[model samples]
Target: MRFIIQRDHLVQSVQDVMKAVTSRTTIPILTGIKMVVSDEGVTLTGSDSDVSIESFIPKEEDDKEIVDIKQTGAIVLQAKFFSEMVKKLPSDTVEIEVQNHLQTVIRSGNSEFNLIGLDADEYPHLPQVEEENIFKIPTDLLKAMIRQTSFAVSTSETRPILTGVNWKIENNELNCIATDSHRLALRKAKVEIDSAAHYNVVIPGKSLNELSKILADNNELIDIVITENQILFKAKHLLFFSRLLEGNYPDTSRLIPTESKTDVVLQTKEFLQAIDRASLLAREGRNNVVKLSTLEDKIVEISSNTPEVGKVVEEIKALSVEGEELKISFSAKYMMDALKALEGTEIKVSFTGAMRPFIIQPINDDSILQLILPVRTY
Candidate 1:
């Protein structure tokens, strides 16, 4: 294989595929990136069993040449060394050539390096996902959905299913939900899709987090294809694929409470800051618990105490308070996370009782909801 490519373009493509390569992969060839040069362009692929990424750099885009292929061939090179070499190359263009016995040479400017390459045939083939069941969503909205729910996925591996986020699509609406048994985050958005087809896929939160990071915050639409066991995300010249978890995700619809005893509307920033200050003391305690109480004239009191550390109390007036006055205790960290995921200036928190799970959501938007299981302070 031989190719002379622009330095910056090669570096970006290497970085994108590098995210899927793992040093400790059981398959030896998985540690290397497969480079294929064809008449159209250059393609780089990297994979660990669970995830695979492929990036394409076409020879000419918009009548400009990005890569000039001297020969059509394929080879695999060590991801670690190759990525570093390409990034540090001091030149506008890089020339790569392969000789007998899989020996590869990379040259740019005054620097040249020789690297041992592996046969691309030994690398595992990427999973093929059919495009029959596909949908389109705006890139920015997709990233927002991932950010809002991925953090709530259970970190514990005991319940394997809880480590993934549940994604359901029906009637042109897409919903994503994640929970760790203590707190839950849910986000919904309207998308254009075939209303006759429905989808329920459980994608690992870790994978979704990586996908979100790679996606740019643009209005361009992204194509999503789902197969029986794999999901593919297509954006521009990049293709991202992830394996779906095997088990069925627990039904969480019943977990949200239907009634409330107390409801309060408060400024999101004020409440978030109060919790941030109160958490300093509670963080030293066993459970990092903070107490919230509703006082007369729509005042909300935030307080926390620790045996070894000092206690803290702050009062913030609410926009409106209805129903019975209430006091509840919950994890400060959970509250902070929920508050940060919310997008509105004002929030409404509904409590069924002191010990029941409470709901927090934007005042006028019903599409997104967050639930937190209160902690017991007594």
Candidate 2:
């Protein structure tokens, strides 16, 4: 295989695919990235069984040439060394060639290096997903959904399903939910589809996080296809595939409280900053717990005390406080996370009781919601 590609283009494509390549893999060939050069363009694929990413660099885009292929062939090269070489190449273009014995040579400007290559045939084939069940969503909105929920996924691997985010689609709406038994983050958005379909899939939070980072903030639409065990995300010239977890996600609909004893509306930033300062002391405690109580005339007190450390007490006036007055203790870290995920300036926090789970959501938006389980501080 032989190809001549621009330095910047190759570097970007390599970085995108590198997210899927793992340094430690049971299969030896999984550590290498497969490169295929055809008449149309050059394709680079990286996979580690659980996730796969492919990037295509067309010969000409917008009537400009991006790659000049000298021969049509394929080869696999060590991902780490090849990526580093492309990034450090001191030239506008890079030339790659592979010999009969799988020896790969890369040259750019005055630098040239030889790397041991593996046969592309030994690499595992990516899952083939049919486009029959496909939908489209804006890249930025998808990234937002991932960011809002992926952080809440359980880090413990005892129950593998909890380590993934649940994705459900029904009636043209895409819902993403993640929980670690202590808290939950949910986000919903409208999608473009031809026919209605209901899907329940659990995707690894780590994979979604990587996908979010790779997605550009442009207005381009991404095509999503779901199969029985795999999900595919396609952008302009990139394809991302992930294997679905093989277990039923726990039903979380009943976990949200239906009633509220106390409700307070406050600026998101104000509450976040208050909790940030209060947590400084709470973090030193065993549970990182902070107490919030409603006072007369709509004043909310944020306080935390540690016997070995100092105490912090602050009062922030709420936009409006309704229902009965209540005091609750919860993890300051959880509260800060929920606050940061909120998009609106004003947020409404609803509490059913001192010990029940409370919800934090935007004042007027019903699409996004966050729930945190209050910590018991006796």
Candidate 3:
């Protein structure tokens, strides 16, 4: 394989694909990146058995040459070394040539290195997904959905299904939900779908997080295709594939409370900041717990106390406080996560009781909902 590519484009492609490559894989070839040079462009692929990412650099784009293909061939190089080498190369262009017996030579301005390459045939093939059920979503909205819910995925390995965010599509609406038993995040958005096909799939939170980073924050539409076991996201010049989690995600619809005994409307920023200050003291104790209690005249008190550490108390005036007065204790970390995810100025918080799960959501928007189970404080 032989090719000459622009240095900046090569570095960006390498970094993007490297996100899928891991050194801890059982297959040694999985640690390497496969490069294929064709008449149209140069393609780079990275995989770790669970996820795969491919980037394409066209030979010429907009009458400007990005890659000058010398020969049509394929080669696999050590991703860790090759990626690092390309980043530090002091040249506007880079040349790669594969010699006999898989000896690869990389050259740039005044610098040259030889790396032993593996046969690209040994690399595992990526899953082939059909475009029958393809759907489109705006890139910025997709990123927001991931950020709003991925944090609630369970980190424990005991229940693998809970480690992924559940995706359900029905009636032109897509709903994403994630929960770690203690807290839950839900985000819903309207989409355009031709077929009446409803899909209920759970995608690994780690995969969504990586995909969010790979996708640019723009108004471009992203094409998504789902197969039986794999999901493919097609962006401009990039293709990402992630394996779906195997087990059935637990039904979380019943977990949300249907009634509220106490409700308060306040500014999201202020509530988040108050909890942030109280968490300092809570962090010194066993559990990062903070307490909230409603007072007369629409005043809400946020406080945290630790025997070894000091106590913090802050009061904020709510827009309106209704229902029965309530006092609840919950993890400060959980509250802060929800508040940050909401990303709204005005928020409404509802408490069913002192011990039941409470809900937080934007005052006028019904699309996003956050629920946190109160912690037991003795």
Best by lDDT: 3
Worst 10 residues of 3 by lDDT: 190-199
Query: Please, what is the TM-score per model?
Result: 0.98, 0.98, 0.98
Question: For candidate 2, lDDT tens digit of each residue in 87-167?
Answer: 889999999999775988899999989898999988899998888978999999898899889999999999899999999
Query: Among all windows of ten consecutive residues in candidate 2, which has the lowest summed lDDT?
Result: 190-199
- For model 3, the stretches where C-alpha displacement exceeds 4 angstroms are none
Candidate 1: residue pairs that collide: none
Regions more than 4 Å wrong, model 1: none
Write candidate 3's Cα lDDT for 1-378 as tens digits. Answer: 788999999999999999999999999999999998899998999999899999999999899999998988999999999999999999999999999959999999999999999999998999988899888999999999999999999999989999999999999889999999999999999887865978999999999999998888798999988888999999999999999999888899999998898899999999899999988989989899999999998999999989877899999999999999888999999999999999779999999998899999999898999999999886
TM-score of 2: 0.98
What's the C-alpha lDDT at position 49 in model 3?
Answer: 85
Ranking by lDDT: 3, 2, 1
Could you give candidate 1's per-residue lDDT for residues 53-109 as a string of tens digits?
999999988998999999989999999999998999999999999989599999999
Q: What is the C-alpha RMSD of each candidate to the true structure, in Å?
A: 1.0, 0.9, 0.9
Evaluated at residue 17, the lDDT of candidate 3 is 94
Residue pairs with backbone atoms closer than 3 Å in model 3 (clashes): none
